[model samples]
Target: MRKRGVKSVLDVATGTGFHSVRLLEAGFDAVSADGSADMLAMAFENGMKNGDHILRVVQADWRWLNRDVHGEYDAIVCLGNSFTHLFSERDRRKALAEFYAMLKHDGILILDQRNYDAILDRGYSSKHTYYYCGEDVAVEPEYMDEGLCRMRYRFPDKSVYHLNMFPLRKDYTRRLMSDVGFQRIETYGDFQHTYREEQPDFFVHVAEKEYRMEDQEEGSYGGAVSTARSYYNSPDADAFYSSVWGGEDIHVGVYAHPAEPIADASRRTVERMASGLGLTEGSRVLDLGSGFGGSARYLAETFGCFVQALNLSEVENERHRQLNAKRGLTGRIEVVDGSFESVPFPDSSVDVVWSQDAFLHSGNRLRVLEEIRRVLRPGGRLVFTDPMAADGTDLSALQPILDRIHLDDMGSPGFYTRELIRLGFVPTEHEDSPGGFEDLRAQLVTHYGRVLEETERQEAEGLGAKVSSDYLTQMKKGLTHWVDGGEGRRLTWGIFRFTLSEG
Candidate 1:
């Protein structure tokens, strides 16, 4: 408070008035508030006894903090794990907005919450520290679930109280604070700057309200590189995919020949890839970067295999869930929201790891390969296709294509072979599907261009267009580059089959 020049401070959740009384004794102008009138009254009494002054106490809801609290302050302290009281994302965002509105230009907001992710992911055993603060009082979880952690508190008199709190993940809270316009957020675990994630019983996030430019690196193709946040997670991407290619699988297809239909080619690719691995009933499959789970559901339906499809996009995850339910394949295919870089399962848990045109999106190919290797059971197969650069190709020639997908560059078959062998995997099959890129690019150009024209005509009649013309423009450039197949810039589409060593 002294360093930040904080004079007047607002304790947003001044439970029992302990912090307010301490602030008053420390000679700082303290204003305390709580959502519960009873708690505020108790805090007021506690303040009178401790400091012989009636603490400025108010009963106010955090969502409408500005409406009840009159003026902005130099600092706002929302401590004591009070933030988890908000169960809904909407409420959390609204409360954070209100908090931001009630702060000085350079004021700081300190909020603390339990590391619910640690409790949920690993069983919780309290360090038995200063929480509750009184030896006579006892606190423990009575009921716990992913969304809610209902804690039971026992008073010295044997009376009981319960607090229903939403289990907020640390990273999620930081992301929410960022989304709510916090310029800078510094997090400390158990009041220390450095600690293991699981070791922390509580996390304190001090967010500053200041204007800071977004950090991004310039790319070769006049775009931001991997350092930039993904637009793939945005609603615009979802809206484009939902409208333009609604209900259609959005991925590259395998051309059995030069003139196969894109949809048929997609199914044929999955079938051919599955056939190489002898995918059959009861096999457990893992699909990384599973876009809307098209191939997962197809494999599950055809081979009766159980597939866990992991993807990073929430929009696609929800869509996949709904689609799976509608198609009666929910039992066979489980859609998980995650990244392939950190496969959220035990090692040696899957029989096959499948992907299609998705590996290019991952910048760290070695980490991706390591994760793929870890999740595969002994003798498990990895069958997937990715866009690769031809050997001895100049990567500078494909900056346009790389920028369109937010990638550094494409990987080659030799690169995959070397990485797989180093990771104790044998490359069993290396097939460069002949003319796959040329045929797929041509069909996409024809089909997407026609859709763009039809949608433009419909928009002229006051109907809605599903895709933006900007997408079409980018698609045209990329497709033209592939069709042009310039000497060093041509994309080589190849399928890789690898088996983990039984030893």
Candidate 2:
């Protein structure tokens, strides 16, 4: 990507030369390379049709890519599920190492493949989101096993073509990428930053050759051994949020009015709370539990502030990077993959500490607050919204909500005020929005029903449905409990504002 400082590119598997030509048009110095001379000839012809006389076109196999393709490049593009063509592990490793050898020290490699795990584990059909986007072109796997996946392609005129490919598992490909000396490799599902790993038709891996400096590992918390670690680290966390929230912004949306868009309301809530913090250009902000970094983006774009987002989920953090790049706000927002308990920042560093409904995950709420206080500069503001229990509620009545979030207890406004006072924070204001809960609850039920209906329709039309049964079952239960005629007591939502008093 341009954001990653890529100025020169090599289209490694330049089949038909689509990517190479596009890169050339985008002002990047691009060279096209392919294993087959026939493919290179076709690619050159295609480039010529687009008024491009490709400067370099080389015929080279991937295993010895560097030998044939001279000179290093800032980036290498190996797309269109071409990597699976290498059937053996030695060939795969050699091809990857050659790719590494061809890249600049700080170069990057972008590669894509079929979601073969879906094909090998659970029978999956292509939705044509990535590879076969043209109408009248059908692509499907006719035969699949642990190693080989034979695909059948049907053209418009009923012309058929078949190709045999190794079914590379997602994890296996990632490990290969890393083992081949790529310092960082970020994977995406069907060009989306957030998705269930099992549901996507294709996976894109962007491997970086730059060596990233390691962060300090000493005195960390809530990792591996922590209960909160297990909750956030599980694959279900990514699946649940990505499927239900249905967007890059993976937090609770506050719908002030039914007619208003949920996303708009969510942004409004962020802006409202952010305004109270007095953020301005160049202000340093810390976002706690920054899920998919929705609020961090909002802060950076709206106020021109630098936001450091701390989160526990690596999946969400990866999504955050993609979203930030897409918005061209990557420079303003930095995502840290860590727990909030230790706050991986120096004291008195941030001007504002912002969070949204993420504090209850802490088994040690007091320690979290203490870390927040330690990180804030004197007089820095703390603004956050949290879901809490209603006053005079029966403890037994809150079990379902607790079970839903895997929390032992929900924090109340009173509880937060007491804790803030103990930490020497001045509790400035609190806004109770009970209706927000009702609105979100209704929206969840409606969204679930819509998803189910669409899935059923797709199934009837002989399309593969990617919906998870467990997610639907849980939603139905929650909807039954929280609706107007539900048995469980309603939960409360509140926005709290605090400022650290200079000691």
Candidate 3:
């Protein structure tokens, strides 16, 4: 194997520091981060023997990788069941997401998956008793609230022993990385890395994915696709978003746009309302009218949750589809097309129905609400934010305001709640946005500054210059209406969180 001008490497889930020592010995700058303190300490000691400034190791979870630790690696390695340790489908994808987020554009994610044929319901000595330094190391079944799993540990000379064995079918892990935007994702074996399934000890694999500008596209989500026209007719939409958010990777727009950052705010609000809504790890969520795919990503990543991100625009779905692919979150983040009225999801498919500020575009509010109820698992949550009438009044007044503001928007708080209850969905929570769009209007504009000057230069071009004005104008008036309106300023924004009945 050629060294190939590679300089640094990040060893994820690095146990015992063996990889770090080997890299340091080979004169590479190795930075290792792991969740196990005991394992990391061993890595530290092992590195120490090779002189003072050897390796940098930190204790961290692979699911939410540290920004400082990722990026620019010749190799970003996760071996054993490190990739499979994510507790759930959501966690698995989140781990892949963070891993992709941190790795340098051209880096490799080398990890192994449990070859079911080599382990589960296979293996000659069904109960092979093994000895590691004279301590017993066994792999067996154990069930927790989470799921079924296997654990193996060696005692006495124990350093980083207990193997937290997570068995993921080979195809499962393979599809996961592929969907997560790994361009050249492939499987290999120990040392030789042959794809053969004859090995019983363990499987060795490596995934090398190239990062390039051509991978960027408009309205692409979690790496999924849609029709061509739905994408914004950007002379350079991808470039513009990339300049602000700072990545050529899949979700450059996620951390790029200001409204998207609301994902964090949404997370905060939902977490507070979580107790009332009764959502546990098993909950299935629906992100109605999913935008650039940030919230769906957040719900899946932060809550160890699953979300069906339904949207109308091909562009929006495309953006989210790709983002999911990049983050390895496709399993937990499903991007469905068609508006709320036409959702094809089977009845009782969801436990929590959530929408951010994107619900205003739908036409039939009652049928939409009814569709939500039909799809919700009993007692499932129906939570979202909408422009509410400042004072309980005619739906007429709200229509004009929403018209100037744009989209098929209009629904007073009274009308919305009544519709929810009418549909048999328990209206769990609702409130007028305290600040309305007034605060966000300013915040959104401020967020448009160029992180990369090329973005500024490009936006300055002739046709592109006027593109953002309309969106900004609509936002400004919308905010002014709610902010400066008299005592009962009729329109306001709000957030909601709720649950589905276990029955």
Candidate 4:
């Protein structure tokens, strides 16, 4: 989403500062505020520099958004729809009231909403795309329809970022603004300015706070999510995993917890990515969507290169820091907190933009490739993989259910290739590894057996709390989906190796 380049920007609910940092990169006098201390720390570190262009990150909630601001700004943006996280109508209004109070009366307020209709149609899983920084990403946006959209982001390090968004209908939001004292409301299908009826790629609200507040409640407005004493470290640690693929286990790739013994399955996938990437000594690279930063670390230590890994998760950053430091290669790997839609580095910054299976989390795929092209020097190589639909299977019936858990911006493989070519990269190589999803079926046999064995051990020690109910549910759904045809056979992994042709 693009902004009108306002001089001053207060990024409300700046989770991990991904959007906030981008504002700085886009040349705004930006300051980010969020309720989460952990999130603020991540953004503060990323935006810590002086001058008017310098970023100042604050710890504040959406409801108290105006209180934290001593004066008004030219613009205020509540992206990631950080508003939808509200669980009820009252909270939504409360947040909106704060948003209104923070604006300079005529200043613009832009926020986004997940297109519910789109989610009910696509199911979670995008045709994966390769990106910078030895990482690849894909999405399975989850829709609870409880007015919430759960976005699942899988990274190259096998780590995950679950974005829990509460989506409100455009009509409902329009009225909410009217009632909450915001006039001049304009709706777009995202920042692209597509109409709402078109259900454009995304739903965005561009509204102005009314100068007259006589009829409105005189109170605070934009306080977002609060990071209390205890934070939910795992987005779905207890999730049952029963999504649109419902009651079926669909394994697109193999991932073993870093704590777990390296499965033979995990090893094979890693080898494929590493080998296909064609890494050589003294390689200099940028890694995007670098979940746990393992792939970036691998490139630095194994290939003797300097690698920069970027991710949005504070928890994952902590883990990656440990991994990089333990191997005595912390100096070789620089982990930044930001998003690939807008990488923080300058033009032509590296020799290789290595991303593997981590770009899927992006809301826009074309912009991702364009950004990659903007950062790479002439002739720099881009290597990555994405698990995607082999064909546009007529998944209309099951599509809605599946997509609710995944968003539409998650483009297909064909969609990805077309965009890459459209973005001006020379066509290099396109290949798919089939049946990898099939081989994953055994995970039920293996992962289940391990769980059962653990249960027995616990029981022997006089304990009965066995497998988590959600874990069992997810595995069952995954198993059922894998052996089925609707979404399974269509599932496949693609490896892309492209070159940035000399200008």
Model 4's alpha-carbon lDDT is: 0.57
Candidate 1, 112-202: lDDT as tens digits:
9996765775556678664555777787888888888998889988899998999887767877987888845766667765442235678
Q: Candidate 4 residues 1-503, lDDT tens each?
A: 24444688888878877788788887777878888989887776656542223457778877777666567777888876567788789878888888777777568888776555445433332212211123366566654564568877789888988977775655567668767887556655445432312324456777766453322321211011011000111222111211211111211224464223223443344455556455666667888766566567657767787888866544456667877888898999898866676677899887788665556545455667887998888888776665444457555534542443243433455676677666666655535433211223333334334433433444355321222223334444544442343234444445566778786
Per-residue lDDT of 408-488 in model 2, one digit per residue for the tens?
Answer: 676666677788888998865434323211213443333333444433444455322343344345555654443421223
For candidate 2, the clash count comes to 0
Clashes of 1: 0
Q: lDDT tens string, model 3, 1-503?
A: 13445677788877887777777777777788889889988878877865654567788886667654645666777864567666578888878877777666667777865444344433323223221233354444443212434554445555444545456755457567766777544444334333222343434445556643332432232212211122221212332333333332211111234434423434443444343455556879887777567767767777778888887654446767998899999998888876676567899888888775545544456666777878988866776665455446554555645555343446555566556655554534434332111112322222222222333444455323322333333434544444433224545544544444354
Q: What is the lDDT ranking, best to worst?
A: 2, 1, 4, 3
lDDT of each: 0.72, 0.73, 0.55, 0.57
How many clashing residue pairs, candidate 3?
Answer: 43
Q: Give the runs in model 2 whose Cα sits over 4 Å from its true position.
A: 1-219, 223-236, 429-464, 479-490
Question: Best to worst by TM-score, what's the order?
Answer: 2, 1, 4, 3
C-alpha lDDT (0 to 100) for residue 245 of candidate 3: 38
- By TM-score, how accurate is candidate 3? 0.41
What lDDT score goes with residue 196 in model 1?
22
Candidate 1, run of 10 with poorest lDDT: 216-225
Question: Of 1 and 3, which scores higher on lDDT?
Answer: 1
Worst 10 residues of 4 by lDDT: 221-230
